[model samples]
Target: MIIEPRIQNPASLLPDAVKAINLLYKAAHSAGVPDSTLELVHLRASQINGCSACVDAGARGARKAGETEERLYAVAVWRETPYFTEAERAALALAEAATRLADRADAVSDDVWAEAARHFDEKELAAIVLWVATTNFFNRINAATRQPAPQTWG
Candidate 1:
């Protein structure tokens, strides 16, 4: 079976969307969170949202940045694995909490926020949150358009 994308890229419709997103991405990257960790956060949110496009790109991004295969394979089942560091775990928790906002009344509970705060400073946490939000934004769009995952991506 084949699933074609509804469009090549939604951002292309808005002339400035890609540039604006790229600039936002640069700001997120500047905030002090490890690149791998941000990739992990992005992957996790995309996974939850069932955005195969982002998932494929995120895994590739993580791997290209030297993320271990063992860790990448375990991202979907991270809680059961010991591959992640405490900081990564905290970031993941925050990502999950933030992503699944409708699953619970509190959305991001205090415990989850506290755990993330324990590991990241204000700037880093802000970046992680931004990354998660950014990932979700893309995920929702891709899922809506049924965007096909790329065979080879940059």
Candidate 2:
């Protein structure tokens, strides 16, 4: 196994950033977006970004929320799987599009946005969007820092 050095202790080196992230997390949970949906979005974005730390953490979070292992494993191929509901699929699509912005000119297309909007109210949609962005933020940081997955995340 190749062990990589973490350059900084982000929580200590950037307390304000950590606080801001905590604030976002709190707001997201309070925004009425379902915990299951938030976990799906976070896992999808982390998978797209190749962030092992976030992926592992997300899996743990999902399990705690009573998500099925089959569904967790199928998040990467959500479109080809029957494990998700229409709303979950829409959230996953939004997560992918938002994470892979460079893959297309219009990253979050109107159709994707419309589909997500169909399943979520304006407040919930806002929370989902923020959740996606926050997950991507953590994904990039972990990828860049070569952060390792925790032995346990429960």
Candidate 3:
């Protein structure tokens, strides 16, 4: 079945908002965090949100940052996968907890936060959190607009 998007590039209609989002998203790429880790967090959050556009883009972005197919495929089940490092595991845990805030009263539990803290310093933690937030923001925008994935895979 062919599905048409509700809006054709909504960001193009809101250029100012698009620029602001672009700027904030750009700033979220902090120097303290690794690009690979940031890509993982973005992909995981997009996966959870079921945002196809994000999933597709995140996968492409992750690969561009030198991520392996195994790691990308295992992102959703990182706990059971040995493809990730301890630090990457901690960041993924934090990303899941932060992204699924409505699932629990204590959305981001202390254990998750503590684990992430053990792996990352203050600045790096801030960067990961910002990446999750921006990813969620993009996911919402894309999902709401029913923006289709641009491609199947790279």
Candidate 4:
């Protein structure tokens, strides 16, 4: 399959996308979202978006970070599973909200935001949003680029 327009690589011609990614990444780390959670969010969002490349990268990253295969497999059905903690559920909700941003102007509704805030502070909330947005961005890039999942992430 031919991946059409490479968004980040031609950033000189698409500065906005690049800048947005840079700022978003910085904000995500600042928001206090842990690396493991961030990776989970990315993987889950990729799953939802059907972005194979992002899913591959996220799953591999999670595994490398010592995330259990049980949890990784349970991510899609997190609401029904016992593998994840309440904190992980909250982040997943935030991820869904961000991934479906176009559906509602305020994709992250007050209730969802509040639920997330109960588990995380302002910085963490920012990180959650950033993580969500960043993963979505990567999904878009990989989807557009037709980037394939590597045989192995190591």
Global lDDT of each candidate: 0.93, 0.89, 0.90, 0.81
Ranking by TM-score: 1, 3, 2, 4
lDDT of 2 at 10: 68
Q: CA lDDT of 94 in candidate 1?
A: 95
In candidate 4, what residue range of length 10 has the lowest lDDT sum?
Answer: 2-11
36-98: candidate 2 lDDT, tens digit per residue? 989989999999899888999899899888899999999999999889999999989988998
The root-mean-square deviation over C-alpha atoms between each candidate and the true structure, in angstroms, is 1.8, 1.9, 1.6, 3.5
Instruction: Please say which candidate is ahead in TM-score: 1 or 2.
Output: 1
For lDDT, the strongest prediction is 1
**Model 4, residue 45: C-alpha shift (Å):** 0.7
TM-score of each: 0.96, 0.94, 0.94, 0.80
Candidate 1 TM-score to native: 0.96
The lDDT ranking, best first, is 1, 3, 2, 4
- Of 1 and 3, the candidate ahead on TM-score is 1
- Candidate 1 structure quality by residue, lDDT tens digits, 27-142: 89999999999999999999999999899999999998789999999999999999999999999999999999999999999999999999999999999999999999999989
Candidate 2 residue pairs that clash: none
lDDT of model 3, residue 101: 93
Shift in Å, residue 78, candidate 4? 0.5
